[model samples]
Target: MMDIVKNKTETSNSVWHVEHATLAEWQAVMAWAKDEGWDMGLGDANAFFEVDDQGFFIGYLGKEPVAAMSIVNYSSSFSFLGHYLVSPTYRGQGYGLKLCQSAFAHGGDRCMGLDGMPAQVDNYAKWGFAGGRNNLRMVGQVQQDYHCPDYIELVQAADIDDIVAYDKSCTGIDRSALLKHWFIGETRYGFICRTGQEVTGIVGVRQSQDGYRVGPLFANTPDLVEPLFVAALSAVPQGRQVTLDVPEKADPTLIKLAEKHGFESIFHTLRMYRGEPPKEQEHKVWCIASLELG
Candidate 1:
């Protein structure tokens, strides 16, 4: 933790504090994200917090939080940076850069990754983050009658271990803690496609502010992808919109699936990483869990 006063003047004398955010403070960060037009899923904070209790940092000018960032060290050699924000009134005063410094320090020598808004891609690159794929945020109304394949089954608590193992195979990260919280919420829905007890595909969808979001859509083959997607989409209520973030360079079939379902690309983010990107089965990542988490 570090605290400093900028000047002797009354207004500038207020101390600027930088440290890990408490649970309540983390909720405040989520509120900031919502205000920024990010449609975060309900119960996201709890799962995110569990990943690394000390990973979220907030910068306070006196008693008011002015900036926030998260550097989730998923493993010794890899981490993700996200939820980076500075209050509108506090921008241009270097608070954002200070928060970034804290995130980088916490990340240490690990390869850091972030899904940066298009406008900030260059800024991230200037900080040694190289651009990778552009992720498209596709949105559409859920198709109530979409058909789920016969092999697909609803994911239950008993299947968590298998789901987590499947996720690790796709992402190469042990995000079991996140998966645990992510799959059990009242408004959440998850399903898996299996063959003779072997999980071949999985997808999870959760209610969001606007509608719902599908993610962590991992599949062993393209043939299984659409069914898993349809199963997740069918879980959403009729007439509600759904969103999915798909990596442009991953499975091309993902784009076709989105189009067939009448999904439109409403937003995009640049995937950037400092040092080499983590090795994962990118093709298996039909839809990312979340830009913030990934």
Candidate 2:
């Protein structure tokens, strides 16, 4: 509701206008995303809405939704851009660019992050998103034979602080609210590895539209990964495919483990930032939390 598409990017500035999203509109947009093979998590819209109610938006062409996007500000200096979608019937009409510009404005001076698909890299770059790194999407049936290490335990509600700090160390984003809510649903399974009383690692998997996704897989060393991976895999419903978005350059072990467990290569996205990049503890981040949120 801040402003309409009057920035001159649109062919018909009067026709298309972006407004803050309602939860119902967000749900409808998420459904479109699922049908388009994006495999959105079932509760993603609700979680995202709770994180920043004003972050999501819809582009309306005379009351009909034609585009959608989110610019969730996690803190004073960090924001994430995602779920940018334009209706096929509305694409090529400049609605996407208009919507994107709105997101850019909403994010303001925050250092923004996005996992841009191949098709959108140039578009994102046009707006100054730079320092692209690949986030590989690996899929297959990983081994379930590994036992949970004696030091590992299911993530309890009281463990949120440790998990949030651990997650921030690797990603450089203080996503405490999102991380806490991530484990609330029944489809979510998370675990933490410990050394004595100290938390050393964390991993979680959640069911998406198509399958389960393993993410925020952070650890101090390679020795702690597989056992947690196996523990996460145990929580998914039977017969569902497994996916791990690998930051190959950041952590080489993920790809090797994926291959060892029969995972095959899929597509990848470029992790790009629109301002000064974050000082992430990349070596510890085996997989990221989400493309849409990171």
Candidate 3:
């Protein structure tokens, strides 16, 4: 186990140093993350590092990594703080609070946001986060005899720009590079719905411990979103389970459809903020990519 208590014998400077994570450090971080009950995939680790804009860090009590966090300078629009963790042995110390302050400092002026756990809202409030909207983490399965949705198309690398534009309408912030890394570069199945010459909706499915997840599922309406969901589930193995993160305020039709297919809440989060609340999207945001990334 990790020896994390502060050494009473040593009186060195309060050097809770932090460093940018290297690819070699990923496995250690991933292992530590999962051990702390954080659900993460190997591919997710790779994509976060490759995006270049996301900053990953490990904190040291001396020479070992006892804490970790990441910052996604999503775009000029907004930034996100996630993957925040403290080694089991290190809990109750000031490490978590320090790491969080560091993340926001690193993210700087880019309208930072994070999905704070309900019980921890007070903790985040001390750091400037306030409750805003809520999102439900839902799951379901693909029909055994699935029919392809006519408007849904298999996305080509060339279609990334169009997809990014469509994503912005649903998520007030534009994380284009992060989305590209997630849907195209990572081990995931992605589909999009187009209206004439323009792409209007998109959904991505990736393998998960429970089954498959349609994360970052963004669309313009119930009509456009339904087809994308069908396409995502059809790509998964037969009878495979699936999940999606649907916002509570999305179209009632979308909510019923997920319920019709057996999707229910695995968890819920109060999407909070510290500063002035950001504008909520007017378009349909049926699912979020992942709690870790948001």
Give the distance in Å from residue 134's predicted Cα in candidate 3 to where it truly belongs: 1.7
lDDT per residue as tens, model 2, 116-155: 8889988988888897788888887644444566677888
Which is better, 1 or 3, measured by lDDT? 1
Model 3, CA-based lDDT: 0.69
- What local lDDT score does residue 44 receive in model 2, on the 0 to 100 scale? 68
Candidate 1 segments exceeding 4 Å error: 1-13
> Per-residue lDDT for 32-64 in model 1, tens only?
888987888887777888888778888887788
Could you tell me every candidate's TM-score relative to the true structure?
0.92, 0.92, 0.85
Which digits, one per residue and each the tens of the lDDT, describe model 3 over residues 115-232?
7566667887777776656777676666576666876777888888887777766676666766675676445778887778977788888876556777777777677767777787
- Candidate 2 or 3, higher TM-score? 2
lDDT of the structure predicted as candidate 2: 0.80
Q: Which sequence of candidate numbers ranks them by lDDT, best first?
A: 1, 2, 3
Q: lDDT score, residue 279, model 3?
A: 65
What is the descending TM-score order? 1, 2, 3
lDDT (Cα atoms) of all candidates against the true structure: 0.84, 0.80, 0.69
